[model samples]
Target chain A: MSRIQSVLQALKGQGRKALIPYITAGDPHPDRTVELMHTLVEAGADIIELGVPFSDPMADGPVIQLACERALEHGTSLRQVLEMVKTFRSRDDKTAIVLMGYLNPVEAMGYEAFSDAAKAAGVDGVLTVDLPPEEAEDVAPLFAERGLDPIFLLAPTTTEDRIRAISQHSSGYIYYVSLKGVTGSAQLDVDDVAEKVSRIHALTSVPVGVGFGIRNAETAAAVGRVSDGVIVGSVLVDTIAKNQDDIEALKSSLVNLLKPMREALDELAS
Target chain B: MSVKLTEEMLRALPDTRGHFGAYGGRFVSETLMDSLMQLETEYLKLRDNPEFQATFDKDLADYVGRPSPLYFAERLTRETGGAQIWLKREDLNHTGAHKVNNTIGQALLASFLGKKRVIAETGAGQHGVATATVCARLGLECHVFMGSEDVKRQSLNVYRMKLLGAEVHAVESGTKTLKDAMNEAMRDWVTNVDETFYIIGTVAGPHPYPMLVRDFQAVIGRETRRQSLEQAGRLPDALVACVGGGSNAIGLFYPFLTDESVAMYGVEAGGLGLSSGQHAAPLCAGRPGVLHGNRTYLMEDENGQIAGTHSVSAGLDYPGVGPEHSWLKDVGRAQYVSVTDDEALDGFRKLTRVEGIMPALESAHAVAYATKLAASMDKDQMVVINVSGRGDKDIHTIAQLDGIEI
Candidate 1:
């Protein structure tokens, strides 16, 4: 089974939704990146999403934007992130890793080169925030050829036709945007997200992960109840940004918040 | 100057991969490769379609006020006492600059592609105002990214864009200049690629844009050809224009490129001095490097960090020149020259006094070169210079420098 499928199966057996945490690579420091990755994995993170710092990130919220800025200041590049991921896979091969970011860095690195490097680094999937399913022609094929799944997002504005298209082209899990605006905007509608997640579940057999606005434990637990996985971005990014000098503290705080939410999700599943 | 561009020659000009004599080609992100290939295919199809040509031509004529006049600057010519000087009045284009000529054509193409919004990055705000104007006319949402420094320097343009219903985003990243604004705009394009149309301002950037913008701006040269024949009955001895990303220069030079008899000169902004490391003369001092979206002559330090460029005119303050201009400079098709800020200011004041025409600070560089060229040539020799824009918007800077109240 695929790493994503294995994670979903593990979640099913434990009767708990997956807790996905996102961290911008090299945010605190590139030297501590492998440590943070392992810490997050140990902190109840079923899957870890790594952000590749870009010069300009328009779609990202303030929290992640700050993280990216810090990472860029420390000279974090897609290549550096790949190297970190390779080190990460040296000790832990079971944890699924997804590289989440814009397409420019990947494009600059060349799609085929990036896919090959990512696979060598044990990257399980990719989630380019900007690349839509229609434009994913070359990118999706490159990833699939290298045994890496290309994850796509389905938003509230997506129609049934688009959902079908996204599901057909997508591998790993589908990212369901919980809100209409950017990542940290406070306009997330729980009922609206739940309804959309249910509709998306009916269409795709792949696991559906909800993201974009789950900032706190309450929201994470709420989203976990309806979706196969809960992906928290800005909150975790903010944690790293605030405690950049201390990765252990940041990781512990993230785990402390996610542990109960994962238990709450397990209760719902039971 | 009366030479007509045959369909075959135009096809032969930009060879198979869009290279214009070692100038234009795709040097960009690998992800953009497929998109650019698709765009090249679409552009070639649209190029041959008479219907597309008719629509583009109509917009150029009616909307942009094309066939911009070729006015004889009799007084300025007499002052120079060397050549009879003429001005190709691109300043009279609908949005008060040569920028609109490309925007209108691109907006129409955007509509044809079923795009809902138009996005662009601007340095001097001329391109922003022009893009906003076309978007408003077409009832499409317009988003313009201007560097934070540009927003502060060109506040009136910011207000003008807002008045035209464009969302003027003040980008406060990087060096807070045109290059950074372009970076943000590219990010936006990548995010909204399916629905947004990026209307690049100049004859620069990666493939499709440099070639596409040149095609749209070529009207200036085509009209100059007809007007020069109507008035002087012969081609001018020299074609001079300022190069800021080389859009206007390319527009005015492309039609006369094969006219070996006609000399071509592009003026670069020599802010303080070229050796002082405070000038925007990329062709003069820069090496080839990839920037924004294309490989071009870019001003960079040994570390490859984008170096700071200096120019009195915010419009001309860029670290890179258009790739085509770099090629033209190398291949000897065009001569690249520089004018100091002091000379440009003198030219600005001279044109305002002698010709009753105030040129943009960016255009002053060309005017400065023209004044020198005319003074050095024979009295009967003809010279045509592209007055790229009106200077009304720059009065504040001119006034401040002269210690005059706003």
Candidate 2:
């Protein structure tokens, strides 16, 4: 089993839901990324979704877009991002690291080379925001061959047919965009998500993780009740955005923000 | 994204799923895919519906002032001293540019789809003006997203868009250019997909958009074909047009794609020069990559980050070209070239002085290339150049370039 599948399955056996927190690599600085990854794991993150910043993040709202700008301003390259993953893997071997971003950087690297590099870096999964199942016919298997879980995102607007198609190609988890808008949108309804997740579960056996708007502990716990995982992105990135000048504050803020949500998810099983 | 195309394949291009030989595909987030598919379905159904065609036709003819004249540039031909040159006067169209052709067709489609809100993104603001003009006439709520830089530079067209009753949003993210404006517009559409119809101004963007915008603008080629036969007694030997996101060029070049005898050239802005790494000539200098919902040639750095693009013409200052143009370039059907900013300025002056016509800076790239190309051809041969827009919107930029306050 892949690291992501192992983590998700292990969590399921323990009657616990996965807490996935996303942070843009190189946001505060390149040196702080591996530390941040370790921080996320220490704060009870089951899987780390690290954003590889691109110049144009089309699916993102203002928060992540600004995060990308900050990351790119720090001269963060895709190759550098891979090295950060490698560094984090040195200290933590069990926690899964999923790289989430657009497809161009990997496209520039060539799929085979990127797959090799990602595998070498101990990356567990990749969820490209722009690459749906239709375009990943040739690219997904390359990553899967190296045991990297090829994750996919399904939106609230996605039809049943599309959900089935996406789940068939996806391996680690399906990121159900809980709202109709871009990342950082705040209109997520847990009941709507529950209905969508149940329908998705009926369609495929792949675990479903809900992302895009799980901002606080209540929402995370509410969403975790219906999902195998809850992904929190903008809120964490917004914290970094709020503390650009202070690195210690950023790490502690991430810990403080994530610890409560982690407890909330554990509280659900209790 | 690089798929080879034979002559037969070119005719049936983009296939059903919008693959122009692997260049065009729906590279969008899942939230917008349904809307894109719906737009494509509606567009395909309307394409064959005679009543829908008639409505689009009527709107173009009456509202947009169709059949924009194809006049022979007599003095320009004599000065060039080679081929006889003819100008397709897209500049004479309503809203002072060829952008209205697509806006009218899309607005009509939006109305047919019962979408009351229309959204668009503009670079130089000509498309914004054109879209706003049609939205006002059709009684749809128009919202235009423009880059903060463009909104400041192209203040005239921004004001025109406002006067036409459209809300002009100044996008402040990502260098605040056309590409950034497009991102903002995509976010808006994704947010309001149920009620909004995004009318992309260029023959870029994802699957349906490249094909849809090209079809609407193809009237330029259809008219040029008829006028070539009428005025020159045959089709012109060559076709030339400026390629910003390649809408006007595709509009003028699509009908002639199968014509083996007719050579096509797409002129790109050579801001300083191609070697300077400052120009916006993707087909000429860049490599193929996926961007803006399609796989196309883009000016990107080694890490696949889209590099900043430059041009005297704001419309052409984009990192990527239309996927159709990328396909054509790969298949050897069309030749893409660039003219420097200085040469484009000369072309601007030559047209104004010789033909008494002021062409937009974007179109001046075509004019500059066509002038040089006409010099090499035989005197008996004929060339057609698409004057894609009027130059009034560019007057302020020209004045600023000359260090004049206007």
Candidate 3:
């Protein structure tokens, strides 16, 4: 089984919900990424979604877009991001690591070479923000050969036909964008999310992880109640943006920032 | 060369999935799939509806001034001392360019789709102004996303859009130019899928857009085909048009696809020389990549990151071209070349002084290439160049270059 499947299964067996935290790999500073990965694990993250920064991240809002800009300013590339995953793997093997990015970088490296490098670097899964299932034909089999879960995004606008098509290709949990807008653009409506999550459950066996517009413990807990996982992104990246100059304070605040959401999710699970 | 394709065969392309032979596809986020699917359905329906065709036709003739004259350039031909040359007067459209043709068509579609608001992204501000004009005419709300850099460079066009009552949002992301403005527009479309219609300025973007924009703008080529036979008593030996996102070029080339006797050239913006790494000639120097929701030839770095493009013509300063152009280039139905900024400037001056016609900077690139092509051919051979837009918008840039404040 892929790391994502194993981790989610174990969490279900233990009757606890999963907390997935997203961070851009080279944000603030590349040197501090591995350390931050460890910090996120310590803060009760069951899975880590590491953003491989692209020059143009259209689906992302201003917060994550700025985060990508910061990460790219230091000349961080896809190969470097994979190397960071290898470093994090040396310290922690239990937490599932998914490399989240746009398709161009992988296309630049070619599928076979990227898959080999990703697997060698200990990446468990990948979620290309722009590569929907229709275009994932060439890349999907390569990831499967390398034992990498190819995650897909399902949105409020996705039809049942599309959901079925996506679920067939998606191996890791499907990311459910909770709102109609880009990341960090809208307020989460828990009721609507619950409705959509239930509809998605009817279509696929894949675990649904709700994200986009998910911020703070209250929102996370609300989302955690309906979905298998609550994936938080722009909020964490915003914290990193605020404390980029102070790495020590950045780590401390990230731990503090995630601790409440973890506690809130655990409370619901219990 | 690929198979010799007739116009029917060419139009049959983009298939159901919008693939123009591995060139165009709806490579977009899932948030947009359903919306694009809906748009595809609506477009496929209205694509053949008589009522839709009537409205589009009437608007093209009355509002946009159709059959923009195909004028013979006697002085240019004499000066070049080569082939007889003709100019397709797209520069004389209502909005001073051919951009209004597509916007008027899309605006009517927006009305039919019951969309209350329309959005567009522009590089030269011509498309933005064109879309804003249509929206103002139809009483629909309009929002135009433009690069902050372009906002500064083309402030007059920005004011024009505002005068048309459109909101101009200056995008500050990426290279802060045309490509970034497109990204912002795509994001807005994904967000406001239900009530907003994205009026893509060119024949790029995903599936229906490339095909739809081409269909609307094909009036240029359709008219040229008849006009060429009438004026020249035969098909022209060569056709030339500048290609930014390739709308004007494709529009002028589509009708001549089956007429294998006519040669075609698509001129790209060479900001400097090709070796200088500053030009925006993707078809000439770049490789194929997926961008702005379609697969096309794009100026990208080794890592697949879109490279910053440079061109004296703001409209041509984009990394990617329309997918159909990529297909046409691969199939060898059309030849894609480029002209440097200096050469295009020379073309601008030559046309103004010799022909008494002020061509847009983007159109000047075609004139530059056409001059060279015409000079190589016999005088009996006829060459037709699409003067895609007027030079009024480029006057400020020209003055700046000449060290004179406008």
CA lDDT, every model vs. true structure: 0.82, 0.92, 0.92
lDDT of 2 by residue, A5-87 (tens): 99999999999999999999999789888988888898899999999999999999999999999999999999999999999
State the lDDT of candidate 1 residue by residue for A124-143, as single tens digits: 98987656664466678888
- In the range A48-154, model 3's lDDT, one tens digit per residue, is 99999888888889999999989988878899999999999998899999999888788788889999999999999999988888878888888888889999999
Query: Which pairs clash in model 2?
Result: none
* C-alpha TM-score for every candidate: 0.72, 0.98, 0.99
Candidate 2 C-alpha lDDT tens digits along B69-150: 9999999999999999999999999999999999999998999999999999999999999999999998999999999999
**In order, what fnat does every candidate score?**
0.04, 0.79, 0.73
i-RMSD per candidate, Å? 7.6, 0.7, 0.9
DockQ-best of 2 and 3: 2
Candidate 2 — which residues are off by over 4 angstroms?
B1-8
Prediction 2 global C-alpha lDDT: 0.92
Positional deviation of A58 in candidate 3, in angstroms?
0.8
**Better candidate number, 1 or 3, judged by TM-score:** 3
